[model samples]
Target: MADIEFPSVEWFQALADITKEDPTYRKFGRLNAVIVFKCGDKHISTNFDVLNIHEIREVGENARRDADFVIEMEPDVWRGMLDDIKKNGHASLDWTLNTLDLRFDEPIHRNELQDGFKADMFFRYNPSLQAFFDNAAKIPTKFVAPVA
Candidate 1:
């Protein structure tokens, strides 16, 4: 509701909070994974319970090792994407997660997926993953120079 800083737990919390009241977020299939958004050194995770975002918090760097997968991006890249979302009410074609993931040489990483099952969630729920970031457009976010 306020101007929350991007890449922080509060910002992701705001996004997760918005999805609770909006039916569009739940209309998609379940996003059953602990999705981590890593900006620079900040690691913020959103745990999805079926189609709902069950939790949002900042975790240590080891989050990548424990998470099903992590979406890692440079601070400038994140700023560009979020800025576009804010200006257009959603990410433009070029800024969408899939497009940018490829454009940046696959910023989405599958860490410690020993059984190979965990990695599938990223692709299986790719659309929902995209929607989740698109949902961030609904939050009031402010960007500043990254700390690390």
Candidate 2:
């Protein structure tokens, strides 16, 4: 299979496919949340429903407001995390989303509606979210070039 470009629908879909087969993911139990990824100018959303990833697609800028929470990060940070995942079969403790949230000054876990309860979903279901992205290690992924 060709290397899927990161931050694209195809790339995310590939990850979702792998996540579906992972029994550990199911063990983490069900989660219903619309999580948005803010990578540079891209707005990618994934709806996690009933223990499976229901949908993953690019969305309009304003569409992020509809998600339960948004993880806003620079494109480079995402690349770094993926690279680590590929090398180690998963993100190292430091590169995990939970760790990143604490390391960065900008809140990666956020609620567009300013609902604290919704924002906490990122943590509540963190193990599942970590497992979802960890599957990226199983895929051949190519990072997109940075904008000049």
Candidate 3:
């Protein structure tokens, strides 16, 4: 169990460690994309390539760049997902990563070419990502204090 916060280098490292051991993740046919997460003033970015996660970088501020996906949310929403992951061995219907992103009314950023390709990866390797996050159930987390 880990006491890491969401959108932190430690959190990303923990996820990467879990994913490395997942056979399902290995079957994903090599994913190479950058995912950026933003919440209030916190920003974290990670690069995944060849099914290997690398470069878990913490940035002081959001920068303009092309990414496969850019997830922006309130810190509380992010904490809820982590708590759900801890409880259910996976995110629940309302907390699923994709679902959470869709629930946001504003437009999210994604590079059409890269993101479109990643969408294919999602369909092709849905189970793997599911399994990857499912491993979160084994990790302990502290929910971030919600900002008003």
- Top TM-score model: 2
lDDT of 2 at 67: 94
Q: Name the lDDT of candidate 1.
A: 0.77
Q: Which stretches of candidate 3 lie over 4 Å from their true place?
A: 62-66, 107-129, 146-148
List candidate 1 stretches off by more than 4 Å.
112-116
Q: Pick the candidate with the highest lDDT.
A: 2
Q: Give the TM-score of candidate 2.
A: 0.95
Supply candidate 1's per-residue lDDT for 134.
80
The Cα error of candidate 2 at residue 118, in Å, is 0.6
lDDT, candidate 3, 1-148, per-residue tens: 5477655678768988988878767865676667666766766777777777878787644342555665567777767777788887778898876676578785334443555665454445456556666777766665555333
TM per candidate comes to 0.89, 0.95, 0.76
> Model 2, range 12-123, lDDT digits (tens) per residue?
8898988988998889998999999888788889999887786799998889889999998788889888889989999998899999999987778899889999999999
lDDT of 3 at 41: 70
Worst 10 residues of 2 by lDDT: 139-148
Q: Rate the local accuracy (lDDT) of all candidates.
A: 0.77, 0.88, 0.66
For model 1 the local lDDT of residue 69 reads: 75
Looking at model 3, the pairs that clash are: none
